[model samples]
Target: MGNQTEVTEFIILGLSNDPQLQIFLFLVFLLVYLITLLSNLVIMVVIRADPHLHTPMYFFLSHLSFVDICYASTVEPKMLVHFLAEHKTISVNSCIAQMFFILQLATTEIFILSAMAYDRYTAICDPLRYMERMSKEICVQLVSGAWAIGFFHALLNTVFALKLHFCGPSQINHFSCELPPLLQLSCTESLTNQVVLLTSAVIFASSSFLLTLISYIHIISTVLRIHSAEGRRKVFSTCSSHLIVVGLFYLTGFLQYTKPSSVSSVVLDEMFSIQYSILTPMLNPIIYSLKNKEVKTAVGKMFQKFKFLK
Candidate 1:
């Protein structure tokens, strides 16, 4: 420990090492980042501009869009820059900050999805009292609570991360400054950090996933009670967008974090990371706008308004 020089910056081994491949990957990821920003911004703008989208569902969707934007923004810009740079390196402080926001925004998104599930449960199971059950105040509280929990969880992990001493290899195998990879490079023991990470994953992430699952179970049961297939389809359509988004998020995230080190590789890690962090944000608005008639209508109206102003 006395002779070890602490690493001040980490060299990120990005997705590709081939110069031509790197340029190609840069173009592809730049396009993805642009779409993520544009699509999420559109979702937010349409929700805000349309009066009909002022309900609890759209309110939650708007926040989800915002989270997706922040989530993608946290990693994509740096990643894009690294893709083209001669030396793909990030300072220790920048890396930690990136990890912090990634954790916070990702955690916040998980809870927000749970809240959306709950909203659907209430809307479908008790339609008459849907508005009352998911009142504006309650919606605000739920969103606020998600953010607060995310902040707390991220801070806890980040504080422990700050205590770690990195005196070993300065090259990160992947593109971003994720906690697990950082732990692998630490000179000091990372048992406590790993324990805290696992504990928080169970407490924050697993709990939220369970809540969402329970909500869907109730929603499905309630839908089954409806007599007509058409009625059931209509009912399911309302929450289908949320369901799809949740599946994409959890599926990729689970594969990324839970996989054994023996089977995990740099390419697989980068692919999973791209899915949940980069591509999912771009896909969310497209899914909602395509699968949801209301959103499509709202977007149409918004475009018409723009044309009218022009």
Candidate 2:
């Protein structure tokens, strides 16, 4: 304790240090952030406005859009600011809060995706009992459970992080204050923190991923059993958007976190992070709109309403 020096703030070494690049990156990320917010907000609004879309599938999707908005909002706003700021420093407390929210929202989103997979599974595998199996009460419980688990998972990580002492270098080599980069800065032995992070991440991520995988396996089996090609295509289309989303989220995230340290580099880290964290949110609404006939119809009707008012 006597030799420990207090670190009140951390200097964030953003993606680039070049003046010209900073300005360019600022504009690029700002545009991406705005698109993320707008697209997600549109998805939520469209889902809410259409009563026909109030099924279990769209209910999960509306929540997913809301989570995407929140997940991007957690990191992009600060990152955009950092792109223009010369110092690009964040207080210790702010960094912790940012990490907490990022973890919570991200965890919640994967579970929500898992829930969607289950919804699709029920709809396709047992159409007659779909309404009974996935009632409004059950859907609400699934969403609420996701949120509750995410909150507690983040809280546990944050509590452990608070115990770590950062007496050494305060420079974070990534765009945002992620747990991995932050853990590297602690002067104290971080073995326990590392263990907890790895253990919990594996437990939470694997369980949700397994559930999604099982749901899809059952779905594919059922789809294959259908005799008509048109029938198979119609069934696949209903959940294809969600399948793409899950692949994007899990694959990028898995690569980012599970890559060998020997192959890790700052550029690779930033690229993977951007893929899952920034670009995915912007792409989600586009995927759903393109793949989903119902969403497209709703958006078309919405545009017609606006034109009529004008």
lDDT per residue for candidate 1 within 1-310, as digits (tens), equals 9999989999999887899998998999899989989999999999998899999999999999999999988998998999889989999999999999989998999999999999999988888999899999999999999999999989999999999999869999988988888888999999899888878877887899999999999999998999999999999888888889999999888667666667877788888988888889899999999999999999999899899999
Q: Please write out the lDDT profile of model 2 over residues 68-105, one tens digit for every residue.
A: 99989999999988888878999999999999998898
- Candidate 2 to truth, TM: 0.98
Local accuracy by lDDT, each model: 0.90, 0.91
The alpha-carbon lDDT assigned to residue 237 of candidate 1 equals 88
Report, for all candidates in order, the number of backbone clashes: 0, 0
lDDT of model 1 at position 145: 98
Query: Cα miss at 106, model 1 (Å)?
Result: 0.6
Clashing pairs in 2: none
TM-score of 1: 0.98
List pairs with backbone clashes in candidate 1.
Answer: none
Worst 10 residues of 2 by lDDT: 253-262
